[model samples]
Target chain A: MVLNSHQRATIEAAAARIIPADHDPGALEAGVIDYIEQTLATHDGDHAQSYFDGVRELDELARRQFAAEEFSSLGPEQQDRILKLLEEKASPFFSLLVRHTMEGFYGDPRHGGNKDRAGWTMLGFPGPSYPKGYSSPLGWYDGHLPDDFASPKKRSDHEPE
Target chain B: MSRNEAVDVCIIGAGASGLVAAKELSEAGLSVVILERGPWRQRSDFAPEDEISTKRRHFFWPTVEQEPRTWRLNAQSPTEFLSADVQVFSNAMCVGGGTVHYSGLSWRFHESDFRVKSTDGSVAGTSIEDWPISYEDMEPYYEKAEWTIGISGKGWSNPFDPPRRRDYPVPPVARNSAGAILENGCRALGLHPFPTPMAILSRPYDGRPGCVNKGFCSGYGCPVGAKSSALEALLPKALATGRCDIRPLVMAREISVDSGGRAAGVVYIDSAGTEQFQSARLILLAAGGVETPRLLLLSKSSRFPEGVGNSSGLVGKNLMLHAPGPIVIAIFPEAVDGHQGSPCTRVMQDFYKTDSRRGFIRGGFVHPRAHGGDPVDYALQPVHGARWGLKHKDSMRESWRHYLHSHCTGESLPVESNMVDLDPEVKDRFGLPVARITYTSHENDIRLGSFLAKRSREIFEAVKASKVIVPPSRLRKLHNHQMGTCRMGNSPGSSVVDKWCRSHDMPNLFIIDASVFVTSGGLNPALTIEANAFRVCDYIVSEARRGNLG
Candidate 1:
């Protein structure tokens, strides 16, 4: 609700390009925009002005470069071009956008992002193993340790009886 | 304004040391009052499943705006106010303090660690001093702390470890993939690697459940009461005595002195923002390294113009923060699955001692990090060189489960210039001057860090890692391992506290935290802090019994 529908569309488009969907779901499908909006409304309210300014700048740059109506109307390749230019200029808004997009895509689902654990599923991560930790020989490397592995020295040598 | 009746002891900060002292004094039949600046959080309050809620939300610590700290390289450099996520010598402010969220790498300082001055001789421009107490003197208390607060490890496993009277209460936790790989690599190089000593429960001891390998050990509190924080282990006993009162959300503003120039009581702000005073016979400060010295500097009176314990003018000098070395990340062909156990399961202390041949007076330890498997943190890492687009997403998939990281923790020599002092400008939410830290790592620390980084690279190479990335060594702005603001010594002229950790100026004022450490050893300091608290409280109890404390 902090951003207008037009501004939200532009941000969603930028986020999609940053983590575009391939074989697996990306930022858009993971609801990264919701995370960004929720954060801007709450903990990161100070960054709200910058977000509005950045979205307007993105639209202006897209229209100037690609003869587009707005940034959200641009093709994927055109959007990538504008983002790269912003990155090359070391734009503060671009930096913020990238950081928040990654946070939303990868952060926990409780933050209004990573919907249905799509981001975790993409990386094959079994999210948050609390209340149930794995036992010994957790993975291939530990399971394959040789039987002749060296053991630690005996404590009985120094400890009192 | 409100006033409370006089108590036998008034302790500030319900942290690791304070909680231990509370249990000790209250059990010995003394009335105690503990004032904590933050809320008392239970195990259930921790959100292990949400990284945003636990790690990124400043859940354990205060926001940068709430308690801002300024930092500069040295007096010559311009000070920069740090952000919340920056390493600013911040510790958890809640009941158990940093122990609630620490990785639990419980280690006793090596024998040579105490006699740094005698062993290494004088290092130029450093205040490295031998501890008034020795390892032999601390051995019994170390054993007491390990048994009483549940540590799990195989004793004598680390050859470099100092002599001990007893083994750990429980065996070591299970090894994860990263630990296994590191262990194999270390053995290939003929170096010894042992199971890391942890404060977490391995098999149920002292009524707590054993670790299920919940994987979120370092930053998140144990939701199942498996981590042996002071909250789970010690404070319960203190409260059960019915003589101890833990007042949370109350900030101690100053240590008030009597007209006779002796110790008196404390003035604090209650949770409702009301000014209040609590009188006591004894005033103990365990408010961590930074806050402990800050409080001492703030408690100024006409009887003690330079602050209660500032007569020596060394109250806040000789600050030592353990320098974190290069973090080397390696990508292997196989899945490491590092996020299944404690943050670390194996540690190499082969390089822990001082080796003159290495071009550094002291050395550091290298260990395999279990944090590489964390999704959000790993994705945020700049190792891939690509910020966004298909390349970034592809790199995440390729390295998510296939990478492991190695870390080195080195000692920072105590430099007189690197210290905590009151900032002339910045103030906190309470309208009090914030602590300004001026630090520059000693040359020895830089040399030690680079040496350990090379060792870590070799270990990763031994395991046939496809790619190894060693980030350039950068100065750590600050570290969680804060030490040596009010160092302990034999003479009042050079140190704040004496061998018994009593303030040299105020006999009834004791400091039982890492602030009293004479030297910052090359290891995690939680176990040592707990042991020293036990030792100091024993001294206090003995003195009280003999009628010498009045």
Candidate 2:
């Protein structure tokens, strides 16, 4: 359950810019890194564990390129160069960490990732609808919904009138 | 030496088939008891929060304590199977079976589908034979299945669909923006793209409510009774009838027989690892295509050494799964908005025909599907533009508008080499043999894939897509509708089960699922499985009435 402190900070910060918290929540806020770590614990037999190790390896990349404190304190642009090196090595660890973190951000909130469908809803995305259209091209119901599903509050703010 | 319980019928595996079997047998004045190996987890208890259990999704009853059954392409490869960089070969390890976490695209096979050999010549390098029965014989049961457990669809939309006595129980869901775009593209190409039939409830038929359109519908069950999964569809009503005793977490190890050679009882282990025996007059193995064969191969007795009733030695042979991946996902300029409708809203079955020119005996359908491309799947998609800081940001900005994909479920030839044999090394917790899958796609499979890919390109060009990234293989094999292994046939020497789905050697035993299909009918086998089960049960009911338990 224990995470690498500085490694956690780096992933959390990098994931933020990758899928920032501007409109929808970012990776760390949605527990993307935590999910990645937990997924690694059990599925680590696959490339997932290497991904977690890749997190530590990312820190090593930063330290090897720059002094330890200097690399740790470097800004987002500098972090990007280190990531470019990580991606080029095709580091299974870093790719897996990134892969899982993105999964958390986009997967269903039921998996404790999307956080109230914020990631989906923010993109003005509608959820899974039925495909009946039994009669005509028009689906069942006289063709009109009651403003929203039971409650209008849950509907999108910019829903069509 | 555990306490024994007596029952009229003991159904192994609490999957959709087992649930339906329990309902029908119980209603027909027979005592039915279902033994599910996995622990029970009610809908409300399913939490999305826990990372170990939920996010990783290990909370769905059975634990993968032992390594999952592995797969190898061929014998030449190391005994070890390709674990990663390939589709994860998974079987549902939960109470309700795969229905709990399926994409819910339910489809019935076409008429010509049954008579594969008779319609087209025998597929070489494989044993792709016809089923014992035809679609016409099972048509009544298909309608009955639709009515009994409600289905939502616009009937006759699929031109290639077999005749139906009745319309769909419920109407189809509304088309989404993505579907509208695809419809236009298909029509522009002089093709028909009708509404895709789904297993989801559209108009609140039966007791379940209509879909809320929450969108997150794959690898997860509906919290609101929208999806017509077996747990929500049949088991509840069957249990309420009081004729069925459902035993969760009781894994049926083997079917024990008596000196007279009938199924005396089933030996099993419950959740707490306690062994118990349940004797029954009849044993129905609705434990899916893979598990059924594995169980039959594991349940070796003096009466039938090649595993119970497997005298023909076809129990674990000629396995095939509906291949749906290795496809193309193109990004368009305008919005496809794939997130709005049912996972699959429209399909073009125009290409689902047997063409010798394609260098394959059977062909596949071209389908337009709305992918559940939540943020996690974003990077996996091919981007037209470069992928970097600014470019990645630009792609994200265009994502809502630029996603389109097609699925091609083509001919996956059944090969004897692609068999499921018991792993000598790995066994489940209760000391039964685990299935080791060994398969390699034949030249026919590759050729069929190539044909589907060319068709996909033609369709994309007709639609004037800015760019199309067709994978080297036109067909995608990720649908995972695995079939065969213990197929039904006219002769006992050539197949495991007779036309009635009764085991040739063990008269009292029946396996009526995808396992009974001699050749998969170029479509998803869900609806067909239900129909065949009903057909076999009809024969069983008649024979039992004639005082013929044997």
TM-score of chain B of each: 0.98, 0.92
Output the number of the lDDT-best candidate: 1
In model 2, the Cα lDDT at residue B241 comes to 77
TM-scores of the models, in the order given: 0.97, 0.86
* Pairs with backbone N, CA or C atoms under 3 Å apart (clashes), candidate 1: none
Interface quality of candidate 2 as DockQ: 0.17
Among incorrect, acceptable, medium and high, the docking class of model 1 is medium
Q: Pick the candidate with the highest TM-score.
A: 1
Per-residue lDDT tens digits of candidate 2, residues B1-550? 5866687788898877787787777777778888887665677755321222443444442334543465666777655532422332354656677777666767777777888888886756888788778888888888877776677777887677777778888776555544555565667777777776777887688877887544445556566677777777878877887999988877787888889877787888887888889988899998887778888888897677877877888888888875443566666555555554466656667778776675667777766555544445554444435433445545566664456667777767677777887888877777777777787777876776667767776766665556777765422222346788888888999998888888888778888767887777666666677767667777767776787874
List where candidate 1 sits over 4 angstroms from the true fold.
A147-161, B87-89
lDDT of each: 0.87, 0.67
